[model samples]
Target: MTAARTEQAPGTRAPDAPENDVVLRLEDLVVEFPAGGGQTVHAVSGISLEVRRGETLGLVGESGCGKSTTGRAIMQLPRPTGGAVVFEGRDITKLSAAELRETRPKLQMIFQDPISSLNPRRRIPDIVGDPLVVWGRRDERAKVVPEVLTAVGLDPEQVADRRPHQFSGGQCQRVSIARALVLEPEVLICDEPVSALDVSVQAQILNLLEDMKARYGLTLVFIAHDLGVVRNISDRVAVMYLGKICELGETEELFDDPVHPYTRLLVSSIPSMETVTGADIEKADRGRGEMPSPVNPPSGCRFRTRCPLATERCAAEVPEMREVRPGRFAACHYPMLEPVGAGAAVEGA
Candidate 1:
């Protein structure tokens, strides 16, 4: 999953330098769906971010925030409605099918549910080896399948013969991990890969992902609704609201110094933040409302309705993701970071 230049390049890809360190870049990306009855659903809108070589960039938001669509767009599973997906140096959005076929081997995605994603009728080998079959690399598939199965901690001989239904949720997830690793891809788009599993099983899958990342030199765009899960695994975190990123920064910096009001609320939702020492404490209650339809998002800042700091300016103009710290970015007109153990000071008032 390491997007570490699957092929050698001339320069270093320092994270956040989307043009340089970027293994995958989504620029002003937008995807709209025809919802029928003369309505258009904006699944994603003007979203931009980068996955650096050998780093995990987490995209976190409530469900239906277009995180999954962003992953699908990267794979070009369904044609994107608009915008560009640049992988390596070439823009995959513009590549023809023939070109994309060659690119698919280096980029792959792991689904949230393993049972649905893996064919129930197909045995493990066939299911895990399907990518190779499609691309005419049968030899490599056979050679890598058993090895990856064992690498993900499965008994290759026993499990290889079983159908996906034969395994538990955890084992199936491991198999999905094996399938992803077998390709030895440069980038792995994980769309809530562990969300469906039990809490105990979740840890094993997360550990397996971390191990695989190191072993394969992988880069990742990890998407999830669970902020705690994201903080454990991501190097950088991006907070999305109504199809656009409201904040992004080094995981530690953003968690401790969250500036955006939406981000502050999300942090409060994670119980782990309270138990874990050194994590900033947000004693204030988070605002509540189901996210609005992306079909017709609000004008200016989409999060204005729920943001406590919202002002006439916030609703009248779109705020850019301004650099709040050297590597941290937040989109609020009034940022809300607090000093640790400083009696819960309110900021940007």
Candidate 2:
């Protein structure tokens, strides 16, 4: 059975509740890829979450933790194997190809790879205006293309006729963002938008996205592996591990007071020059191990293999996400009451 959805604020709707303030809701969403020898890669396993309109919901996790897959699943790039993706009160997973194509304009995604997402042969104007052309707005391309290019901090006059290959990585990303914005999409899924850029360029792209969000009245799903970046832009953050969300809450709350062992470890692992000494490094190394293969993940809690708090119980049954604080939810039998460094209980204690 799917987990029960949690309630939101007065004006907002719960995942299972009637659609109101919520723009996107994932109900027991599952995505799996088939491997050879009849094996399956469990990409996303029963992740149910809600994204309210006008809010930036951050999805963070280590590589191979299904963050990107979750983002793709939301767009139905490849329809999920199980569960539902409800967008604006409609079940998109159930929509036919023709029906889904009609609904695609409102939901758009900015891919992780800046250079490859765009066609090298296509000129900037033609690339960014492709969406308009598809939607029978070729006549309006002259106006819309330039407007969006400028909105993304690119000079329309200079870049309009240029090919994507001529621009830098940062410039290409700006073009990609411009393409996504040309449609004035309501929900924008940014899949590691800044991961491939230099540290200096990352800030520029992030600031530009914030500005675009306000200008377009967008609701964003920002996916990244960097906790610092996620915390900076996300109103609420979801920490994913092995296809499931282990902890979720307000960004500040999750950063300052992480409840799950995995969440705590991730927060502590953030690089800091002042805190990179012997003791800090030692603490960071604790319970560290390679991520288990998704093809044959651990039995109960997928994170138990690397969790210091693992026990027979943790291996016996899967933990359901429950409210640990007012708006914070964690899927752990023994959620951390204090920071992980403050003598939190662990296995074999």
Query: Using Cα atoms with residue i matched to residue i, what is each candidate's TM-score against the true structure?
Result: 0.89, 0.92
What overall lDDT, based on C-alpha atoms, would model 1 receive against the true structure? 0.80
Task: List residue ranges in candidate 2 displaced over 4 A.
Answer: 1-19, 274-285, 345-349
* Highest TM-score against the true fold, candidate: 2
Cα error, candidate 1, residue 97 (Å): 1.1
lDDT of 2 by residue, 39-124 (tens): 99999999888898999999999999999999999999889999888888788998899999999999999999999999999999
Task: Report the lDDT of model 1 for residue 279.
Answer: 28
lDDT of 2: 0.85
Clashes of 2: 0
Cα lDDT, all candidates: 0.80, 0.85
Candidate 2 scores a C-alpha RMSD against the true structure in Å of: 3.8
